[model samples]
Target chain A: MAVEIVMPKLGWTAEEATITEWTKKDGELVQRGEVYLLVEGDKSVNEIESFETAILRLLPDGPKVGETVKIGTLLGYFVQPGERAPFEAAQMMATQAQSAPSVTADAPSLSTVDPDPYAGRDKRGPKISPRALRVANELGVDWQKLTGSGTSGRIVEADVQAAAAAAVAAKVAVVQAPPAQPVAAQVIAPAPAPPIARATPAAGNATRKTIAQRMSQSAHTTAPVTLTTEVDASEVFKLREAIKGDAKRSGVSSVPSYNDIFAKLVALALQEHPALNASWTDEGVLQHAHTNIGMAVQTERGLLVPVLRNPAAKSLTVIATEAAQLVERARNGNISGDEMRSGTFTITNLGMYDVDGFTPIINLPECAILGLGRMVAKVVVIDEATEKTAIRKMMTLSLTFDHRVVDGAPAAQFLQRIKQFVEQPYLWLTR
Target chain B: MKELTYTVAAREALDEEMARDPRIFVMGEGIGKRGGNFNTTLGLYEKYGPTRLCDTPISERGFVGLAVGAAMSGSIPVIDFMMVDFILDAMGEIINQMAKMQYMSSGRLRMPMVLRGCIGIGGAAATHHSGSYYSIFSNIPGLRVIVPTTPADVKGMFRTALRGNDPVIMLEHKNLLSNKGPVPDGDYTTPFGQARIARAGKHVTAVGVALTVQKCLQAADQLAKQGIEVEVIDPRSTSPLDIATILQSVKKTGRLMIVDDAFEPCGFGAEVSAQVGTHGFDDLDAPIRRLSGAFAPTPYSPPLENEIVPSVERIAAALGELVKE
Candidate 1:
């Protein structure tokens, strides 16, 4: 029996993701829990792990960077000892959607709706979902008209719901409904009216059409959870400077970023907190055997997360070289589909854009995501007894996870492990 | 192996390559039985039949894309866009797709394609056709760019391009096609990444490519009569630019003047001048003089076009000025 690999749903609003790199070759026999590929989605790169033990048989074709592969297409095939093929709900949905005609051909066009749910989400900019934007767009409701009610005044579903209800009521009051003469009102409600185009320039720039579908699927099917914490990066800064002269002597250009150290720390932490590095299914929790870390790259086309496989196994120099090459390829538009389909966990750093902190969307089914913030220098009073003040680097770490599988204590402990690694990064070398 | 004219040399490259390799073919407007607008493919249609010597619609975008797709599929395609300015119409395929295809594919596929276009100003080609735009393609990566100043080079470079694995933009000077030289009477391939010293000198190193290389040679002859030893370097390939030869010449001369028919800003002259200033600045006795086309599009009037771009007189004056400095 051959199993077709479909595009994985990442969040409530993410419809599609860019393939970053393939960890396993097409002919390689993959164990159920082994890391398979990397995807750039939800503004971060994530490692997609194998769900079943099988051989990867095929790879899809598309542009390296900007081409958007529709969901449910065959990423590859898997042969097994089974008598029949397993049901791929995602692949079926994608095919049925492709073959069957759309509902709202004559209705208002949704062509202008931003395709990417994570569109307009700069590290320091507004965080809005593709769903909320779509609903707002469908009814010609202006996003600027509704005040945000979520964290940091981000417009959530409720805001869209409120706007939709208000529009519905206004329509009911002004326009009279005609006497019923049709067989049914459901079909007449308007085949999914082509999404409406929002007038905002920011919305136009970041819309990913595939992002909308995956996000809708994730929200409808998966349970989401989030966790948050504060991590001090004072020591990370010190260690980076300490290695600068050494890097120069070795002919390397610059020191690895704090995010580089944090990526390694997160990988180490996931090993100890295996629960956080897994997928929750009806059968059981799938714990990944190898850690493939995905780094989020914000490109001109959209957000693509390319993964760095077994980052923990490689030295910092190798990690730096791989990371730089992956980022460049993603920008140059050369990543493959197998690379974007499978990922275990994700990390998104907004420090380069000077943002303080943010709630990153969970790349779905996967347990958690790490959100990094700008590292700011602050004065700290080390001891009240001595009355001595010390300057240190401080930053916020936000972890959004599915609480159904992981408890708060375990999540905190995992974060603490990450903090320890960040503080004493040289310990990674010893390991 | 026959006596091929500069134009015929190009036609033979298409004819011989198409005859030798089934994968090789020619596609361009008016390049079929009608020959080429410039007679570069004068007799290819009857020889190879229409399928191999295909005539394309006057759509630069469509033909460039077709050529790109053919190259990706392992076919050797010789695409003639008629004029270099026509390349601007298909810039998306040329720069975005063709230039980055190899690197983007992680070295998976090689684009074995050749883009032939006529450049330089003459015959009242107007604003659209009269352009010396070699710098535009040279500055970009993944494209092996070359400028052939003589009849022999046009044949040799085209032969090389037909055989090499990389995509090549063969910049043919409109003014130099008829100016014949003692070309080899047999199959020949001029290796890319090599610079030719047209004239040997010691006072200053003067460099140019394409029609401007000829201008520099003429300028060198005029200056030589006045006891000025001027070295003229023609870097046939611009992208795999023979910077070593250019720098070596500059290092010996202690002064330099780059004469080119292209504009000064972001032009090849500016690049050469900067390279000399940064790489061999210590060896300089005077500031580098860059005599280039005026910062304007090539005009329609022959006199105006001639005035805007570098001429033999302007190049000689620039060389004289460098010596005086």
Candidate 2:
């Protein structure tokens, strides 16, 4: 028996994936556990291994490399040597020039009978209601190619509406419209310039398209409010320097970065303020028990957030090592989907690029995100009681939270706790 | 606004009309002293005297013919058939004489006659006492058929019927005689050919008549909980048949289901379905469905009678299925 090989599902949110490379070609012998192909999905590349050892028989009309296909699409077949593949047999039957056997003959030709009887019959087009047909025409949708979700497989008006909506969404993804102006605004606004002859723009890759969709969805769904506060990071800076010197003396390789420290502090603060570590859902607010902090890492392909599971429970050294590996894997575009999901909160740092304070879009389901800006030496009154002016290391923290989940006062309190952690590291680091 | 029962509201219309126009009189069995069987004429006999609220024997055809002559001879007579099924005996007088009086006389003679009756199958009324044959009168050329469901509608439509010069047939559901609702004070008349959107929705359009209008409203409420909204429309009159309102609703909803307590064949449901199918062809997303009484006659047993008519559950299920299409 020949085994059919199809595209595998990569992630929960992945609808399709592109086959970047195929190691085994046609007629190549493959063994179990051998990497057969590399598929890119959810902004990461994954190796698909062979489940059985057999001779590879690649389909002639299969998807080419870099061509994206839907999940479960048939790609090839693994068959034993000297066994005819399914498509090969069909092609041979077509080229044999065999006519239907004579009905009056003594023996009937069984080869003329189709193995799947239903495949040979004439298929009727989709049954569409008159209203749906009118709507499809008005919306310029192709009704014949659509599958109806109506009674007795009838295409209805709602199905047409959905197809129209999907078409508009695909157009938006392909156009990659300006981030400032929405699609609807662009449609209603007058044309800024006359049409000019230009080459066709390149369509965005699957990862970029997915990012655009998620960012747009988050911007639309969440009522985000960003609160900025300048914090004195002199204590956190000193704590990191002392930890680095101790690690160097102990011959420890991993030294905690500002993001790793912030992740730990945010996780601890979330433990105290459970509302900030909650998800806004239709049923109710989901207050996460374990603090799975997601550290946003900008990669060459796109932005990827690798989650650190229960970082609050891990030691500072263990968190530093794990965060370094997660960030490295994300930048290399080889992180698994499981390592990038189920985050309770997210922390994005742009301090290296000299970003001061900016409102960040909330990752969906997660309620709040903390953005870290660059730390600078600013002259300030170090002691208000003595009125002594001194140079202090200060950083601006921007906390963006969904108002629907937590009110202003609670979110501000959570941010205040984070500020306390940064200003006085001993308050949480000792525990 | 004042709350009144369906019977009291309709009686108030007759009282106001009879007091305003001396030529307006009511004639029915026991209507003079007994106030009719269903209190249709309640205490009006003493107020209007024997001449206006005259009592008559159990002769439907004879009195219907007498009222037809009175209507042609400059009198607005109201012939009250306690049960609408009794009007079958006077079909010839209604279809040939009453319906064709003004048309036959080339508009020279005005036929301002009000034929009022209690209709619908409920409370073991059986076939003889329970019949909603407004469709039959509606099929005729020159008759205004009104089947008002709410108390306010009954009062308002009855005022219109009493004031119009055309012959009008008012069919009041026996099950809704005591249904209380707010009615406007002072003069109010609901015009014929106008339909009321009993409940506004967006998923499915349901046009109901008589008792079925109430049933559809209940079904709409039930379906709303399930997120399947059903728009219930009550065509107050069958002759004019407010196809415009029904078409507009179908245009919005794209699915249509007609519920009538009458029989399926040649019933009010069939008539509305035909009109909507012809006028609102492109607006329909599903085949026009009719949830009506069974083809059999109204049974006497409670179970059998209940099984014949469309209940709220059946209407809701049908609407749910229609909206999916």
Of the candidates shown, which would achieve the greatest TM-score relative to the real structure? 2
lDDT of 2 by residue, B270-313 (tens): 88888888999988888999998888878899999998999999
Pairs with steric clashes in candidate 2: none
Computed on C-alpha atoms, the DockQ of candidate 1 is: 0.01
Best by DockQ: 2
Task: Please give the RMSD of candidate 2 to the true structure.
Answer: 20.8
DockQ of every candidate structure? 0.01, 0.51
Per-residue lDDT of B1-325 in model 1, one digit per residue for the tens?
4454678777766677777889998899888889888898887788889988889888999999999999999999998877878888899999999989999998898899999989987778888888877788888988999998777777889999999889999988888888766677777789998999998899889998788888888989999999999999999988888888988987677678888877789989888888877887655655678887778777788889778888899888878876754
lDDT of 1: 0.74
B241: Cα error in model 1, Å: 0.6
RMSD of each: 27.2, 20.8
Q: In model 1, where do residues sit more than 4 Å from their true spots?
A: A1-431, B1-4
Model 1 Cα displacement at B10 (Å)?
1.9
Residue A278 of model 2: what lDDT?
85
Cα error of candidate 1 at position B316, Å:
1.1
- Candidate 2 chain B worst ten-residue window by lDDT: B263-272
- What shift in Å separates residue A56 of candidate 2 from its native position after superposition? 45
Pick out the ten consecutive residues of candidate 1 chain B with the lowest summed lDDT.
B1-10
Model 2 docking grade: medium
